[model samples]
Target: MVNGVLSPKETIWGLFSATFYTNVRANLYLTGSSSCLFLKSDHDDTYLADKEGTDYRYEKWFKNYSAIEASGMRCVKILDTYELTYSTRPDARVKGINMLRLPELYYIITEYYLSLENQDEAVKYFDKVLQSRGLTGYADRQGATLTLEKVIQERRKELICEGQYFFTQKRYNQSIYEPKSGKLYPASNDIYVFPLPENETEYRY
Candidate 1:
């Protein structure tokens, strides 16, 4: 892919976008959280997303307390694990906010549309994703003529069993029928949380 786009020497590094990195970093700092301190850059306005996992935090964690006082080390280890999202070659690394954030879906969808050569609409949706760092919920899809099949495929790939699948299917007015039963269901105002496994219930006693 790098050869297709640029020369072999011109490898693209540093996974996340500036806006995404800035947003998550600001959120971490504002929340008084140091969970991302491992990925923190020594210099500003430049990227260090390609750097290796820094064990400095771990060293600090160990030095701060005795063997019995491991809570500090645990916290530091959590931060360290969270920031170690990059690979040595820097392809597509996961972002720190992936657990609590769904921004990547918007970014990927915008890229997919752009690949289809719908430049104007792609730019429109891409801009929406760019501006959506502050906006809540889904973007306004009113009057937008998108390819439902492709969008649904992307949504499936991104969301899967992350608990948004049914709602996304319903949003597109796609059939939500049970596969074996072939029963259609109405949309609910609230999301449906799946019940625990039978094994869990059986072991409760």
Candidate 2:
């Protein structure tokens, strides 16, 4: 197992990896809490939908840390391991946040090869990521076939909660997949580009 790649028990695993190095100043800084988004009740329709539709590897990244409520709904905890740990002990030194990880590099290389129409080299790096994530049978089951769509889905599954998915979609100009609506939001500048602030535009006009 990679030391701090995806283990929920590791303080610095999710959204960042410790396999490369540690973030010594993490404890001192206030990391934003994503509890509003991730800490969901079992009764929540969105949570249930996600649990049913998301990849098994994505489900493995979370844990239920809260007690069952009177309504029989349990809290489906996700990505709070490090936040809970660091918040409790502000004085503790922890690993620094790693913006990029090796798996991401592997995905990048995979995409690069794919762009060149080199399916073999693309599969080579893509399989490396799958193997690391304990999905050794995935590539084999697909007969080692690779496509740009497959690569995009793999990146979505692997890089969830890391703020990379939007950029990936933008880079490819792909339509956004809305899970709740079960529809594709068409790719366009209206969705992709941010509007200039009113204050900034006023002076230029």
Candidate 3:
């Protein structure tokens, strides 16, 4: 895909409009968070969606923890694990925030849309696999039939409100209409608010 688009040396996901990255990095910092960490992935599906596992937050999880396989109630072997090596310098919170708030050094990419979602939330969701088993979680075909689609559906409950509805609608060929204003006519872009004084221009170019 790289060679097809540009030089073979061109990095992947070094593609895409970047209007979002700066905003994302700014939001993370404002919320007082650190981007320096890693998580380790132990399951064999490591290469599946987004390369970050089901969500972008697991990038660190994949770097810090190892996987463990166990046969629980349903006779299915599940990989379970939790928080691993996270060494944030104590002063990073008080000191580093002032010295230099570096922007996200690189654009993140993953196999699934979940792989590109908010990292903090992603970690909590998948970590639930180790325990949480409501009607909408973990698979157990030990007594039932779960085709590929069924197992895939099991993960959706974890992804709500994570900027995934757009991708989901696209994947399923679902069409979303623009929200109507006070009248029946569709709202135009001009009705969109203007940018703040310090932000970039509202022009689309």
Candidate 4:
């Protein structure tokens, strides 16, 4: 979004990056807690910052990392606790799209998934959930059919400037046990949600 444009993008994705990036600074060791953040800028292209300095933020701005790679291991462990076995649907694998930059596409799908109170959206959410897609994966198939739309946007509060706003909106709602506070933030209400802006720093040599 532009500096003065405080509105959400009407589209279904939020892909463009920002000049100002933010990072979290922890005050103490894990009691499962953290504090104030240190913000900087991509005014160039800098690595994104994290919330509380925990790796969980990785799952927010990133679609690929150890957390996702290990999600299956954790799920399997939980499944085992039930003394239950599991099976992958024949459609369990999907073609990986490692390069796509449409964030709204991801935001909408994740929204629909979290909003579903029933399994009605389960098939749509994870018919073949274990695919390594980047961006286009979420929007490649538009049809009478439905699917899981990987959950990434809302999970990325710690990922500001890493590209999260419109795509996340109110979806992928990762509750804040403690509000995410920062030094370089706008008003509280303003920070809670967002409006999409355009990428201003265009190619210049």
Number of the predicted model whose TM-score against the real structure is largest: 2
Instruction: Give stretches of model 3 more than 4 Å off.
Output: 1-140, 175-205
List the global CA lDDT of all models. Answer: 0.37, 0.52, 0.26, 0.29
Superposed on all Cα atoms, the candidates' RMSDs to the truth, in angstroms, are: 18.9, 8.4, 17.5, 17.3
lDDT of 2 by residue, 57-103 (tens): 54464444332211222121223334435544133333334356677
Q: In model 1, how large is the Cα lDDT of residue 124?
A: 62
Model 4 scores a C-alpha lDDT of 0.29
Q: TM-scores for all candidates?
A: 0.26, 0.56, 0.22, 0.25
State the weakest 10-residue window (summed lDDT) of model 4. Answer: 72-81
Q: Give the distance in Å from residue 186's predicted Cα in candidate 1 to where it truly belongs.
A: 8.5
Which lDDT tens digits does candidate 4 get at residues 42-153?
Answer: 2112223211122322333322114421211111100111112243313322211112233434444545665674334533443222122222232244442332333452
For residue 177, what is the lDDT in candidate 3? 40
List, residue by residue over 56-174, the lDDT tens digit for candidate 1: 32233221223431322122221222233342433443332223233444545665776687756664654453333222112343444444454454444333222456766665556
In order of listing, the candidates' clash counts read 0, 6, 20, 15
